[model samples]
Target: MTVGLVVVSHSAQLAAGVVELASQMAHDVALVAAGGMDDGSVGTSLDRIMAALDEADSGDGVVVLADLGSAVMTAEAAIEFLDRPAAACLADAPLVEGSVAAAVEAQGGADQAAVLHAAETAWSPAGSASPPGPSGPKAGGGAPAPLTSVFTLVNPLGLHARPAAALASELGALDVEIDVNGVDAQSVMMLMTLGAGQGAELHVSASGPEAQQALDVVRRAVESGFGES
Candidate 1:
C-alpha cells in the first residue's frame, strides 16, 4: 500500500516509454516524469511531474526513481519544493527499471527494493541497452548483430509529435527490437525530450528472425524524415 510513483529521467521519452511498458505488465505503479525539455531546461520537467503527483490520492507516500545521479538531486529538490505529503524515495536505475520496480512494489505492497531489481532484470544480455547499435533486444537470435543504423535529430523539429506518430505507426507493425537511446525512443515525449533536432541522431537496430525486415522498415522511415509522407 505505498503511494504512487514518480519516474525521473534525463530523457522524457525514456521515462514515458518505461511507464508505458510497465502499465502493460504491472498495473499498480502510477508514473509521473521529470524529463528533459527542448529549451535545455531541466527544472521544468520536475515541475510538470510534481503537478501529476498532485492528482494522485494514494496515501502511502510516493517513491521517486531516477536514472542517474543528477536525477536523484532533481527528484529530491522537486519533492522538497512541493512539500508533497508522499514520502519520495529515489531509486538509482533508468526509468524503465525504476518504473517496473515501483509498479510491482506499489501494487504488491512492498518497498522500492523490489523496483530496483526489476531494473536490473529489465536490462540484460545486452548490458541493459542498445548503446550505439540498437537500444532494444534481439528475438529469434543466434547472436546480437553488428550495430548498424542510427536516427539523429537532424530535423529542426527533433522528431516531434507528428514525426513520432508517423514513426510509431510505421515501426509499430514491424516485428523488430527497437531500442531508443537515452531512455525510450518509442515514447513521443521521450523523443521530444531528446532535444534532438536539425542534426541529432538516434541509434536504431533490429536483430532477430525478422531483423532485416525491421531494419529496412525503420531505415525507410528515418530517411523519409520520420515518415512525413
Candidate 2:
C-alpha cells in the first residue's frame, strides 16, 4: 500500500538503529523520527516530523510507531496540531526493533492496529520487572548490567527540565551506551522532547563493559526521576 511510516523515540540514533533493522527486513519504508536532537529543541524536530507526515499522508496514510506511550500521545497530539488525521499507528514496543518492524509491517499492508498491538505485546509493564540486560557481575563488580529498566514518573511535575537535565548528567557520568527504549530519540534533547508528565512510564538501558554500573545508575536516576523533590 506504500504507506508512509513514522518512528518516534527519545533519541534519533535509537530510531535510526531500529529502522535500519526494519529496512533490512522490509524495503522502501518511510522512517521519520521526532524527539530531542543533539543540537537542542525537540519541538523543532517534532515539527519536522509533522511536515513529513503531512507529505506522506498525501501519498498514503502514515503508520506511526512510538517507543513509549508519551511519545505516541505526543505524536497523536502533533497530528491534531497539524490538522492531519489521527489515524497513525502506535508501536509500543520497549525496543526500537519491535516498534520499527510494527511500523514497517503496517506500511507494507498489515493492519495498523494489529501491528501496533503486536508491538505493545513486546513491551514490559512498569512494575517490578527487571530490565533486559546481562544479569552477571559487571565491570564495576556490582550487579550485571541491565540493558533496560522501567519506572513510573510519579512526580507531580513529571520529568521537568531540571530533572531531565539531571538525568542527562547522570547518564553522562556512566560508562555505557545509554538509550531509552520506548522513547528512542532520548538524547538529552529527546529527554526534553517527550516532555514526560507525571505517572508516565520510562525505560532506560546501557550496554558494553560498563553495562552493570551504567544500568544501576540509570535505574537509580529513573527511580529518582532525576532527583525530583
Question: Local error of candidate 2 at 206, Å?
Answer: 39
Per-residue lDDT of model 1, residues 168-204, tens digit only:
4344455555555644433333444555566777776
TM-score of each model, paired residue for residue: 0.43, 0.43
* TM value for model 1: 0.43
* lDDT by candidate, in order shown: 0.55, 0.56
Best by lDDT: 2
RMSD of 1: 11.0
Judge candidate 1 at residue 225 and give its lDDT. Answer: 68
C-alpha lDDT of candidate 1 relative to the true structure: 0.55
Error of 2 at 130 (Å): 26
- How high is the lDDT of residue 208 in model 2? 64
